[model samples]
Target: MNTVTRPRILVVGAGFAGVECVRRLERKLSPDEADVTLVTPFAYQLYLPLLPQVASGVLTPQSIAVSLRRSKKYRTRIIPGGAIGVDLKSKVCVIRTITDQIVNEPYDYIVLAPGSITRTFDIPGLTDHAFGMKTLAEAAYIRDHVISQLDLADASQDPVERASRLQFVVVGGGYAGTETAACLQRLTHAAVKRYPRLDPGLIKWHLIDIAPKLMPELGEKLGSSAQEILRRRGIEISLGVSIAKAGPEEVTFTDGRVIPTRTLIWTAGVVASPLIATLGAETVKGRLAVAPEMNLPGNDGVFALGDSAAVPDLAKGDGAMCPPTAQHALRQGRHVADNVIASLRGGPMRPYVHKDLGLVVDLGGTDAVSKPLGIELRGVPAQAVARGYHWSALRTNVAKTRVMTNWLLNAVAGDDFVRTGFQARKAARLKDFEYTDAYLTPEQVRAHVEGTARQE
Candidate 1:
C-alpha cells in the first residue's frame, strides 16, 4: 500500500503577522491538505502597542501575551525557537532553540515573518548604556530599573548622584518613545510620594527626537496637542535634537546640551530581522522585497510579510510600499495565507489592498491622541478610542479580561513601585535585551544542516 504525505507549511515568528497567517491557514486548509508549523521563541502573540502600560504597572506582562495554545481551533505545532537563518535553495530554516541548541526545519512552503530588532547607530556608549523597549523582558526590566532608580535616589545623600539617578532621558518621539516617556513619567510622579526624603522636583524626564515634530503621522494639530500634554506633565520635549554621545552618567544631545541621567530608553526605530539577510534576496531599506501578494519573486512557495518584508502599497500606488505597522502586518498575514492556499489549489492569487484606518497614540493616564477612521480625537475621548482599539485587538478573551481587570485595579489602587532587583544584578543594556549576534551566516547554516543530515 502507498501512503500520502501532507505538504508542510512553516511560518516563522509568533508576532501579529505569523500568528494571523497560521490561524487563517488552519481555517482554510485541512490536515490532509497541509500540516502547519510555527517557529517562535514564545508561544504567545504579544500585543506590542500596550507595552508602555505594562512598563508603567498598568497591565501585567501576561495580559498582553496572548497564548497560542489557548485556542482549541489551533492545530499548528509550535516550535520553541527563533529562526536565525533560511536557505531558499534547500528549503530549510535554521533555528536556535531557547536552550541554545541549533536545529534545522524543512518545509514545502515558507512564510518569513520574523519581525524586527531595535535599530541602533554607532554613537559612543549607546549599546552599553541605553535600554531598549522591544520585548516583554525589556519592558519588565525597565519597570524594575525605573523603580530601583527611585529607591537609590531616596537613599543617596550626594546631590549630584541623586540628581543623576532621578533624571530619565528617552530618545525618539514616535509612538513607542512618546508612550514610554509618558507612562514612565507617571510612574515616577506617583512613586515619589512614597519617598519623603527625595525632592519631587528632582524627577526630571527628557523626551528628545531628531524629528521636528512629535508623531508626525498624527498630523500637526494632534501632534502639537500630544507635545503640550507631555509638557504640562513637566516632561521636557526637545524637538530637532538627538543624542550625540551616551555615557554611564550623562548623555550629550546634538544641540550640545548635556543632561545627567542614569536611565536612557532608546525607541528610535526598528530594522528588519537578521534572518532576512540569510535568504540572499533583494531588499528595500533592509526589509525583504516582496510582491503585493507577499511572495518572493522567482522563489516558488516562499513568502515574506510584516516588519521583515517591504510589501508594496497597492492602495497608494506609484510604487509606494506599506509602512511597518500592526494594521498592515495583520492584513498582510491573512492575504499571504490566502495566496499560499491559492498556490496549492491552483487558483488565481489576489493582490492585497487596504486603506489606512488612521493612527492611535496612547500617552498614559487619560491623555491620548487618535485619528480613527479619519476622525480626529484627543484627550479622554482619544484615550478611550486607543484603549478600545487595543482591547478589541487582543486575540483571546482571557487577555481582554485580564487587561480590563488590570485597568480597573490600577484605577482604584496605585502601583506599589516595588523593585524586582533585576537591575541590581545586571544593568539592562541594549545588547543584553536583544540577541543581535545570534544569527548564522549562510555558509554556517548549510554546514549545520549537512552535519545534522549526516548524523541522522
Candidate 2:
C-alpha cells in the first residue's frame, strides 16, 4: 500500500473571516484530506463590533474574545504569531511569534484574511499623542485613561486644567468612530454622577470627521437621525473638519479652531494589513486584488478575503469591489473555504455573491439605530435587533452567555467608576498599538525561504 502525503493548508489571521474559513474547512474535509494550520498572535478572535462597548465597561474583554481553541469538530494547529511576509513561488510564510521568534511555515494552499490597522495622516504630534481603538489593549487602556482623566479633573483646583481633562475628542464618522464616540461619551455621562466634586456640564465630547457627513452609508434620514441623537446628548458633531496639529494639551483643527482636550480617540479609517504587499502581486489600493472566487489570479491554490483582499463585487457589477465589512467578510470566508475544497478535489469553484443585510449601530444603553433588511429602527427596538444580531453571530455558547450576562449585569448594577491601572495617565499612541514597521521587506522575505540569508 502506498501512502499519500496530505496537502498542508495554511490560513493567516484569526479575525472573523479566517476563523470562519478554518472551521468550515475542518467540518467539510476529513483528516486524510489535508493538514490545516493557522497563524495569529492571539488564541481568541476578538469580536471587533463589541469593542466600543468593552471600552465603555458595558462588556468585558473576555466576552468579546472568541476562543480559537475549543472547536470540537475540527482541530486546526494554531501558530501564535503574525504573518510578516509570504513567498508565493516557494510556498512559504515568514512569521514573527509573540515571543519575537522568526519561523518559516510551509503551505500547499494559503488563505490571507489578516485584517486592518488604523489609517493615519501626517498631522504633527498626532501619532505621539492620539489613542487608538483597534486592539484589546488600546480599548482597555482608553477606559483606564478616561477614568483617570475624570479623577484628575475632579481633584484639580485650576479651571483650565479641569476643562482640558474633562474634554474628549474622537475622529472618524464610520461605524467604529461613531460608536466609540457615543459609547465613551455615555461612559463619562454615567460616570460623572459618581464623582460628587465633578461638574457634569464640564464633560464634553467632540466627534469630528473630514467627510461631509456622519455615516453616509446609513442614508440621509438614518444618518441625520443618528446625528440628532448625538447632538441631543451634548456631543459636538463636526463634519468636513480635521485636526491639523496635535499638541500635548490642545488640538488645532483645519477649520482654525483649537480645542483644549487631553483625550483624543482615533477610530477613523483603516487600511489593509501589510502582509498582502509581500506577495509582489497586483493590489487594489492596499488590498490584494482577487478574482470573484476570492483566489489570486494565476496563483494556483492561493486565496484571499476579508479586509486584506479587494474581492470583486460580482453582485453589484460595474467593476465594483466589495466593501471591507464584517458582513461581507464572514460570508466570503465560508464561500472561499468551499472554493479551497473544490480546488483540492478537482471540482468547480463558485463566485462569492451576497447582498447587504443592512447596518447596525449600538450607541450603548437603549440608544441605538439600525437598518435591518431595509426596515429602519431606532431607540429600544433597534437596540434589541442590534444586540440580538451580535449575540447570534457569536461563535460559541459561552461567549454568547457571557455577553448576555454582562449586558444584564451592567443594566442592573452599572459600572463602578474605578480605574483598573491597566494603563498610565500618559496615553499610548497609534504607533504603539499598530506595529506597521514590524513587517519584513519583500527582499528579506524572499531571502528567508530561498536560503540566501547568510550571503546577504
Q: Which stretch of 10 consecutive residues in model 1 shows the poorest summed lDDT?
A: 1-10
TM-score per model over all chains: 0.97, 0.97
- Model 1 CA lDDT for position 231: 98
Instruction: Give all candidates' CA lDDT scores.
Output: 0.92, 0.91
- Candidate 1 global CA lDDT score: 0.92
Displacement of the residue 287 alpha carbon in candidate 1, Å: 0.4
Which segments of candidate 1 are over 4 A away from where they belong? Answer: 1-4, 450-456
For model 2, how does the per-residue alpha-carbon lDDT over 79-101 read when each residue is reduced to its tens digit? 99899999998888999999999
Give candidate 2's whole-model lDDT: 0.91
RMSD of 2: 1.7
C-alpha positional error of residue 20 in candidate 1 after TM-score superposition, expressed in Å: 0.6
Q: Give residue 14's error in model 2 in angstroms.
A: 0.3
